[model samples]
Target: MTAVEKLLGETARADAQRNVRRLVAAAREAVAEVGVDVTAHEIARRAGVGIGTFYRRLPSREALLQAVVEDTVYEIVELAREALRDPDPWHGFCTFAAEFVQLRAMSCGINEALGTDCALSLDAPLEQLREQIRLLVERCQQSGAMRDDVPWQDVPFVLTSVMTGDRTIGLTAADDQWRRNLRVVLAGLRAQQLHTSE
Candidate 1:
């Protein structure tokens, strides 16, 4: 191709990539609220682009869903890494748990997208993240900060409970009730008794 033609081709490719990012963002917002059933045209409208542009970028609704899930999963992974860096494992676990609630609540439709109706199963990455969280719990347990009898699996369950309680209790997103409830749960999670020499 001629130099001028090559330059034009590069510019067009760049524009297409920008359009793809826009569509994916819009799709994530919509799915987080309305679930994966959101229409491509709606996503296009949200992105302030034409349906043709969205189609050219994402190609299909399944593709859009996959993109959103991948983005959210990467974010979760990053948050987990940050949590692990804290010198105090329990404190890090608490912060990470709160962020998990914030992240899920930010995408209000996530419960729906994670439900059976969704086309893509973004479970594997989530499962991997869960493993990291479980390891964090195990580490804390080793320090005697957590009760050994309490299964580590309850960590994610508690995060979900925080979100659910926040929603069902009609607490404002700005409210700190979830943290308080978490504090109460944490109080119960501490090991009750230590062996003493007889």
Candidate 2:
């Protein structure tokens, strides 16, 4: 007999695996809707599973939060890669950056996820994304489409402002406000280049 069979019957192991997937999906909804402070009981209820099963799978709130972090990080990294494939460097950069604000209304923002109870640990993938941004920014600068004054590190702050604005300051009310704000920032990035050319 296998270790799982020794610990749990074969049917019980399969059920446990199903419960784990259910808990993960439920936790995503709960956290996205109510932030990371969502209770384990509520998550179990959403999953249509028992509290015991939920704890058996995730064990604690922090565990759920860590799972959410992992899922979201993987998703956004792929989105960034997709953006990087665009022909225009500026378009690619903005597209990836824009996702920060665009997706917040539907899911948890970066600050929220990072600030969650799980001690969110994202080192490798985040570094890759930062390097991706740096490469795109360099390409844009070389194309004469972006200002040399701005640094790649500064892009996150701009995105942070967009995310912050969307959450606290009612940017979603105007519908076009985010686009306008992004346009203004992009314009500023190119303003110096245009003046020099003229």
Candidate 3:
């Protein structure tokens, strides 16, 4: 191929990659706003790209949703790994739990997608996230920092449940009431008579 042709090909590939990134980012925000059922046209519009460009990159709504979810799960898994590095197991666990809830709060669509059945192949990253939670829980319990009665399996539910604080009450995001709820839940998770500086 001529040098001019090769250069144009490289430029096209670069643009394609940029478009994919923009689409995924826009899809994330769109899902947060309109939910998982958000249309391709809306996502493309939000991404500032044409519908043809979006189709060329993500093909279908399922593919677009999968990209957004996978991106989020990967980020959560990374946070779990970072939590494992903290010296204080209980503190690390609490931090991880709070951070996890905060991350989930970013998108109601994510919470809905997780609760409902879908075709997304999230088994791998999800399992890894589960394993990390197990390790965190075990570490805290073994240190006599967390309640022995609390099983590792309950961690996810407990964290996610704390997120329901806003909905259960009339409080909106401006109220910041979920932080108080999270603090209470974390306190309840701790072993009795153990003191930790907040």
Candidate 4:
């Protein structure tokens, strides 16, 4: 092939990859709110792309879900990392927890679809998020900002409880309540250390 033809081919390939990334991101946003059952056509419409274009990039619904789930996990992990950067370990932990709750709220349907029992192993990005949270929790415990009595396994339980509670009470009324409850839980965790010192 001529150099000009090869260069044009590479450019076209780059554009195609960019388009696929854009479609996947749009699909992720839509599915988070609506659920994975949403049709490819609906995702395509929301993405401002034709159904054919979506299908060309992702041949099946499962493929699209996998892509969207991966993206969602990556975003959540990034949020965790950002939370860990806070100066105070207690505040950092709270920030992480708050962001996590917000993500679960925004993607309620996706969370429901994944179910509590399902491990995030199938999604690499989400696995990274779990690792990040584990590290942050360890940091908080080591810093004496959090209770050593609370096991790492309990962190997921706490998050799931808050998520389930939010679902039952509804976000409008539960927002401030959850924040207060989080503070209360943190306090209880810290109480363990206080009692030990006393």
RMSD (Å) of each candidate, 1 decimal? 6.7, 5.7, 5.8, 6.5
TM-score winner: 3
Q: Where is model 3 more than 4 Å wrong at Cα? A: 1-12, 165-174, 195-198
Sorted by TM-score (best first), the order is 3, 1, 2, 4
What is the C-alpha lDDT profile of model 1 across 51-133, one tens digit per residue?
98766655477766776765576677678878888888778777887787777766755665543456666777677787788
Candidate 2 lDDT score relative to the true structure: 0.67
Model 2 lDDT tens row, 92-114: 87787778556554565345764
Clashes of each: 1, 0, 0, 0
Off by over 4 Å in 1: 1-12, 114-117, 165-174, 192-198
All candidates: TM-score: 0.79, 0.75, 0.84, 0.73
Task: Give the distance in Å from residue 170's predicted Cα in candidate 2 to where it truly belongs.
Answer: 11
Compared with the true structure, all predictions reach lDDT values of 0.70, 0.67, 0.77, 0.67
lDDT of model 2 at position 159: 60
lDDT, candidate 3, 87-182, per-residue tens: 999878888888888766767777776666756777877888899999999999999998899999987888777665345356464465567778
Clashing pairs in 3: none
Worst 10 residues of 4 by lDDT: 2-11
